[model samples]
Target: MRRALLAITGLAAGTTALVVLKGTPGVTQVAQDRPVAEAPVAPGGSAAPAPTPVRSAAPSAPASAKPSAKAGVSRSPGAKSSTGARSTTAALKATTSAPKPANRTVTGPVVSYKYGSLQVRITLNGTRIVDATALGMPQSGQSGLRSDDVQARYSGTAGEVVAKQSANLNTVSGATYTSDAYRQSLQAAIDRA
Candidate 1:
């Protein structure tokens, strides 16, 4: 009687262990050495991969065998299907096509000034100046002016505007011609605005 009881207890424990192991993720009862079944080819030329059997760990299906369109059923809940793909595509399109605010005109002092051979251009929107560039000076120096000089003039003007208006200032330093050009261009943009 003792030996029979022990055998029954051991069998129960082994069965429980098997169940627990199968419940774990990535643990499968299907032998790893078994060749995976290929997807069935529909009448259409393309071959669709077969869905793996739903493991006992997966959510139980509702009483109905047929899936509802709205329920978003893939072969397995984990699988991506044509319907899911279509819905995703539609979602992306909807998001992309949603109305957005139009670009607003930036307000600020559009100032352009020349320092020696460099030209500067600047653009101001609201209190913020977006950019400054020197357009026409050489790397070493142009005329009697260094690139730094041009940058200084452009930045100085923008800085002054920012100080007065409490506007944001964006500046380029160390390129005289580019800075000057930007300043000049900004002045034009401001004038037009």
Candidate 2:
């Protein structure tokens, strides 16, 4: 009678343990049976390679079942194969990456000086100034020479406007008024940008 009770108690304990292990959430039966190694899933819900099955030496496993690894994994209609996934990833990366902002031109308001009115136009590659040009400036007599000096010192891709990337600039010698006007117009362009 003691042996019978012991057997029943052991059986109940074993059954309860089996139920607890099997009924646990987030753990599939196959996952419990095998160690699953999964690849990283690509963006856009693309399916990754299914876990490779571990084969046993037992003859009960047939050769026909060797190809069933991938067959067991279900994918969406738009899902790409592992090989096609590479190209899909490349395409996805290309599309997902933001394109550089197009080079834009912004013209500052006309700034007047002692000689004449001057305006500055700037080419911006995003926030950085790529080039600066004198749209309107003093172009006669002494004023023309000073305008030329100011343009040379502060305009173009190599000039202070692109280097400093701001309106702050050193005043060009003998062209203080033109430089100031240029700086003022450049500031306006920067503000607009």
Candidate 3:
């Protein structure tokens, strides 16, 4: 009974693998005498370019089984055996040809000062600082007025860092503790970058 069950499972697995291979683009071909055009559905929902036909090892299917659409598929003299490898190679080529973006961003470590937590996120265009965002500045324990004050101070100090394109910002006058926290966080992010 166990052997019979195992045999059935193996057969099911084989059938599933076949179904997958049949649908995979450039991986399996049903025709042997002539290259059949098939818009084999790509891994992505979008259809990939027509597969370059490689020689098939499997027996040819009846003409009725092959799709009638011939325009989308064509035969190529040199075809790769593995569709996955070909797609990966294509992706690599595309990435290598394109230039990486000049903008860089880093999130600073959180700095806790005087019952408040502060963090800074900075965006850079090459060596110049483009923007800074303050995060986690509003203390849950503080009143609404105090939270608003902390946010304003950190943002103003962050603006100074952006304008000067440096983390060396002087503390905002009214928000000395928050300003110090911002400075520490900003420096940590810069060091990471």
Q: Model 2, range 1-193, lDDT digits (tens) per residue?
A: 9667666655554544443334323335565455335434446687544433332223333332333324323332344666546433354456767888999999999998888989999999988899999877868899999989999989889999999999999999999999999999989989999
**Model 3's TM-score against the true structure:** 0.42
Better of 1 and 3 by TM-score: 3
Structure candidate 2, residue pairs in collision: none
Q: Is candidate 2 or candidate 3 better by lDDT?
A: 2
Per-residue lDDT of candidate 1, residues 32-127 (tens digit): 223445444435677633334532322344322333332322233333455536433344356557564443343233333344344444445443
Best by TM-score: 2
Per-residue lDDT over 80-122 for candidate 3, one digit per residue giving the tens place of the 0 to 100 score: 4354445444553565585656988899998888756878898
* Model 2 TM-score, 2 decimals: 0.54
The C-alpha lDDT values of all candidates are 0.44, 0.71, 0.60
Q: Report the backbone clash tally of model 3.
A: 0
Better of 2 and 3 by TM-score: 2
Q: How many steric overlaps are in each model, in order? A: 31, 0, 0
TM-score result, candidate 1: 0.26
RMSD of each: 16.9, 16.9, 14.7
